[model samples]
Target: MSDTAIEHYWDTLVTPYELWAEPTSARLASAALDLIAPSTGSSVLDVAAGTGALALAAAERGLHVRAIDSSSRMVDRLTERLGSLAGCSAEVMDATKLLYDDDEFDAAFSVLGVMYFGPATMTALTEMVRVVRPGGVIGVVHWARPVGGGPMFLPLARAVERLDDPEVGTLEIPVTTAYLEGPEVEEALRGAGCTDVQSETAVVDSPTPAPETFLAELDPFFGMFPQYRAAVARHPDRFRALVAEEVRLVERGENGHPVAHANIAYGRVSH
Candidate 1:
């Protein structure tokens, strides 16, 4: 999808994205911050800020934060959420091309955001590094695998394949998972001139009240993918079949709520 399409999709889904994804996003943000551990009053940049999950977490810790996202609606939501916060702001900006000066922030981070850059992942990471001070830390959290597992979207991808839409092959979901595999993220940070790079994986489990609720939460994400949308438009019954398969795959947690597992890879930027 083009940048404009991505932005439009995000803007259209902001409400559902926040309702469904914020809790997990918040958990990942907390994990990334724990790894970076910038001092209070530190200047921080949140790339692809997305509803201000990381920005809000940093500001609560007394950090001065500048958050940016490509979707103006997402940025608006973030700004509203940051209302009255003393030292935080959100703006609409492309992650691949940061507008800040070199070494301007004490630290920078993204929570499942930069991975969507696909071929431009390195550019985004480099821009992130360029804006941080010499010894400042850079952190990122991305899925070890696609959320809800590969099969969740495989049917849709296959359908798109049958239609011969080359764009579907480049869908953000698959592209992100493919590019973020293993040491790829760490290597990218290192390649971006960050030193002392380190990474670890953490599993974030979000439990919904029931399987139905779980599927509802996942709906926004499924809708966000252009391939899924197109496939659903063309083959509603097939799409429903895939969704039913997804429902059957969901396992109940110890507490009876449906538990979704997200393997988050956390990387620390070098000095």
Candidate 2:
């Protein structure tokens, strides 16, 4: 299922969402620009641009950017973040069916977005291909796996398992997210007619002011993602306790900050 269709899931997230999410997205954006290498003044497109992370990053490099999201509220939040930035704009639009002309951009990127597209990733990548000029580059970032890099929820999941709580046994996050891999993303980019495909891993440093404060800030995300909803619904008290333990471990290991490794898959199909 394409979870991006859930507008309220994204709409309800704005400043709070960006507070923690942007750090990861920003790291992904840096890796993306390193991959795409768009020069200053090059036309760029950010698909599924949540709070304009990649868009804002590109703008900092002097690239003309147009950020699009399916959620109106996301676009509004991004627009506010982009105040007074010339040659940059944010708008609500479907990523699978981009409302733009062919060969319109020099490069395109999506950071920590488009992975939720699930079956629609191909459509989104195809649209991105159609809109970029021949030889133009496009990339999409997705949560890879637990081996080389783990998602933020990994520690919490372990904490839940260690507690032997029958109520929270086997938390079910979305199937699409649990097993997402770089090879899967590479296949999608190839299926979209992109050549010279490449996939690599990069560390995402997500900052935290303090363990408890970070937990307080992350409360909103628990309601946004399904696995969190499942855990909270099953036994809110147990899950909260589990997260508390995870926070302690995080504090000890990484100064209370969390980190994730994301897959960056990028390629270009000559139009």
Candidate 3:
């Protein structure tokens, strides 16, 4: 996909994404940071750092954080949120085409980003590995396919596919679905020159007051593609019903909050 399209898509969803996706991404970023373990004086890079969630977390941990995203709006938000953070900076840049020198960072990571690059996923990973020092860590978090079933977004995706609009019908499936399995993530990390790779599913309990609220929060994904938006606009009631049914299928927690699962895939760069 063109950078313009990707930027437009994300720019359109930035508000809702910040309100909804940031919480889950923050949790995942924390997990990745724990695995990375960058100390004071460490230089870290946050690729595709939408709204600076991971970058802020790293800076809070005392790492010098440099964050980048393709969407200028996202970068602006990140910059705004990063105001006066002495060691943090945000820039508009593409993950696949990083502007830093080799071994520029002590560690690099992305949370629920980079995985959507389709054929460019490896290119982005390669750039991440290239920029970090040989012994640094590379961490990623992506959506895991439900065991014995499709992803949580499959119902919505199927609805989009049924629209038969050529633009939407041919939209590439998310790269995470093909690589969230431990073995797949491990192989990709290894392929990017990471050694001692490790990956696991991290089940995050996202508790919303009700399913409707949960569905609303997920607008970032469901309303991502233009065709999907058109479809939703064409059949708002049907879309709501479908989402309600899907949420109903989810197991509720003791506090009545629905749980969401994510996979954290990480590895150390080879020395």
Candidate 4:
């Protein structure tokens, strides 16, 4: 997707996007922070930050944060979030071409955003390498597996596949998941000049009252896929019914919680 297109899609849905997503993003941010282990007071940059999830996490640990996103609305939401945290800031900027000086930050990261950068993915990775000082940490957390955010969307994907509703034209699953796998991301990390590249998978819990409500909980994000938005707008009841029916496809854990996983890839700029 073009940067402008992505910006518009996210800008229009910022409110609901954060409503459910911010909490999960924040959980993943904590995992990223635990892996990178930067010292307190170090300068950290969050690339393509959506609503300052990682920024807020870093700030809570006494780090200085700068977050950027292509969408001004996202930056607006992010800035408002960082207002209480002194020495933190947000801006609207392109991730592939950072505006700061070389070796400017002690660490940098992007959580599930850069993989969607498409053709510019490598440029964004290299730019992260450039802005972080030699020996600084760089991390990116992405949805693990070929289906992206994993089975968290399985109900929707299954529903779309089963529906085959003519009113919705064609429903294509999200295409950015391939870039999110551990090896693919680790390759990108090393290709960008990062050393000691490592990868880890962590389970991110998505709690809901019942399995069927998964789509209801994350409808805004799926709304970005116009087919989903149109399908639901036109056939709210039937569409949700199909989503609920497909809930059987998801692999639930012992206590019946939605178990999604994220891949965190991290490394140091060669000393």
RMSD of each: 4.8, 3.3, 4.4, 2.8
CA displacement after TM-score superposition, residue 181 of candidate 4 (Å): 2.9
Number of the candidate with higher lDDT, 1 or 2: 2
Clash pairs of candidate 4? Answer: none
- Candidate 3 segments whose C-alpha is farther than 4 A from its true place: 146-177, 207-221, 225-235, 238-242, 245-257
Give candidate 2 regions above 4 Å deviation.
Answer: 1-5, 146-150, 175-179, 224-239, 254-257
- Ranked by TM-score, top first: 4, 2, 3, 1
For residues 103-220, what per-residue lDDT tens digits would candidate 1 score against the true structure?
8998888887886677788889889988888878888877666643322444334345555555444344444545455477777777888777667776575533233343355566
lDDT of each residue in 55-164, candidate 3, tens digit only: 98898888899999988898989899989888789998879989999988888998888876667889999999999998888988777753211234544554565556
| lDDT at residue 175 of model 1 (Cα atoms) | 44
**lDDT, model 3:** 0.74
Q: Which one is best on lDDT?
A: 4
Candidate 2 per-residue lDDT, tens place, 1-271, comes to 2455577767877877687677778888988888778888999999999888899999999999999998899899889988888889999998998999999999889877776666677788899999999988988887775322235555555655665656546544444443267887888888888889889987767665454454466666555445566666776776677677777787677523477777898998676
Q: What's the lDDT for residue 232 in model 3?
A: 66
Taking all chains together, each candidate's TM-score versus the true structure is 0.79, 0.86, 0.81, 0.88
- Which of the two, 2 or 4, has more lDDT? 4
Clash number for candidate 4: 0
Per-model CA lDDT versus the true structure: 0.71, 0.76, 0.74, 0.80
Which one wins on TM-score?
4
